[model samples]
Target: MTEPPSLKKEPIGRLISYIHRTQQKRLSRSLSEYGIGGGGQYSFLKGILMTPGTTQDQLTCNLKFDKATTARSVKQLEAAGYIERTTDPEDRRSHRLYPTPKALKFQPVLQAILDEGNAKLTRDLTDEEEDQLIALLQKLNLEE
Candidate 1:
C-alpha cells in the first residue's frame, strides 16, 4: 500500500479549506432526506428564520455572501416551501424574506445538524482549546 504525499508545511488555509469541504459534504449527505440543499442554503434558511422579513440584500450583507449567491438561495428556499418573499412596502423593488411554517418546524432539526457538525469538528479539543480557537478565528476574521 502507498500513502499520499503530504505538504511540506502545515498550511492553515489548506486546513480551513478541508474543514469547510468536509463539513459541507457531511451536512449535505445527512440533510438530503429533509429536502434542504446542503451548504450555504442551510445558513440562508436559518438566517431568514431568525430574522424574518429581511431583504435578500440584507442577507447578502449580513451573511457576507455575494449578491448572486444570496438571490439563488432565496429563490430555491422559496421554491422549497421553506420561505416566502414579499415586496417591501417602502421599496417595491426590494423583497423581504420570511420563513414559512414548514421552516419553523424544521428549524430545530437544522440547528441540531449544525451542532452535530461543530461537535464532530471539535471532538478532540478541550473546552478551553475550543474557546481559544474561536477567539483566534474571530481575531483573524476581524483583521483588516
Candidate 2:
C-alpha cells in the first residue's frame, strides 16, 4: 500500500513542527503561574539569571532570538520584577541585565519546574535514547 500523503510529504518537518507546538503549549501552561509567557520568555529569564551583566545584544546573539523578541521578553521580565536592567556605563545605549532578588529566590523552583517538564517530555525515552536524540537534534539545528 502507498504511504498516505500526510506521512509522505515533508514528514520530518511536520513531525518536528508538531513536537514544537506540543512543547510550547506545555511550557506556556507551566510558566503561566510565574507570569512568564511562552515563546521562550523563560529562556530569556534563564539566560539573564545565568549570565548577570550580559547585554541585551549578547542575549540576542547567545539565545539566537531577534532583537525585538529579546527586548520584549526583557521588558516583560522586568515588569514582573524578575529582572533588572541597568545602563551600561561604557555603552550608553546598551543595558546590562541582572536577576532580581525575587528571581534569585525563585531560581531553584524554576529549575525544578523546567526539569520536571523535560522529564515529562522525554518520559517515553530511555536515558541513552534521550542522549542520542539530543545529539541527533543538535546535528539538525541550523541555528548555529
Candidate 3:
C-alpha cells in the first residue's frame, strides 16, 4: 500500500506551520485583553522576566529578531508599562531592559495563558506521547 501524495510530501514544514499559525491566532486573542499586541510580545516579556538587565541588542540576538522589530517591541512594552530601560553603566550608548512591577505582577497570568495553549496543543496526547513529542522537537531544533 502507498501513502497519499500529500502525506508522502514533506510533513514537518506543514505540521510546524499549522501549529505556529494556530498558536499565534489563539495567543494574540488571549493577550490582546492585556494590551499586548499581535506579535510575539509575550515571548519577549518572558525573556526579560527570566533574564533581567539584558540589553536591546541582546534581546534582538537572543530572540533571533531583527533590530527594528526588537526595538519596536521594546518600545511597545515600555509604553505599556511592562518593562523599563535603565542606562547600561558599561556602555553609555546602550540601555538594559528590565521587567517592571506591572510585568512581574502579570507574569503568572501570562504563564497561565501559555500553559493553557500548550495544554490545548497536547490535549489528545498521552503523557508519554507528549514527552516524546517534546524530545523530538528539541532534537530537531538543536543548533549546529
> What do the candidate models score in CA lDDT, each in turn?
0.90, 0.91, 0.92
TM-score of each: 0.90, 0.89, 0.89
Tens-place lDDT per residue, model 1, 55-129, is 999999899888999988889899999999999999999999999999999999999998998999999999999
Candidate 1: count of backbone clashes, pairs at least 3 residues apart or interchain? 0
In candidate 1, which residue ranges exceed 4 Å CA deviation? 1-8, 142-144
lDDT of 1 at 50: 90
Q: Distance (Å) between predicted and true CA of 35, model 1? A: 1.2
Better of 2 and 3 by TM-score: 3
Residue pairs in steric clash, candidate 2? Answer: none
Q: What C-alpha lDDT does candidate 2 achieve relative to the native structure?
A: 0.91
User: Which candidate number would show the highest TM-score if scored against the true structure?
Assistant: 1
All candidates in order of TM-score, best leading: 1, 3, 2
For candidate 3, the TM-score is 0.89
lDDT, candidate 2, 1-144, per-residue tens? 987567346687788898888888888998898899977898899999999999999999999999999999999999999999999999999999999999999899889888988898899999999999999988895754
**Candidate 1 CA-lDDT value:** 0.90
lDDT of 3 by residue, 1-144 (tens): 987667456589788999999999999999999989867888888899999999989888898878988888889999999999999999999999999999999999999999999999999999999999999998895354
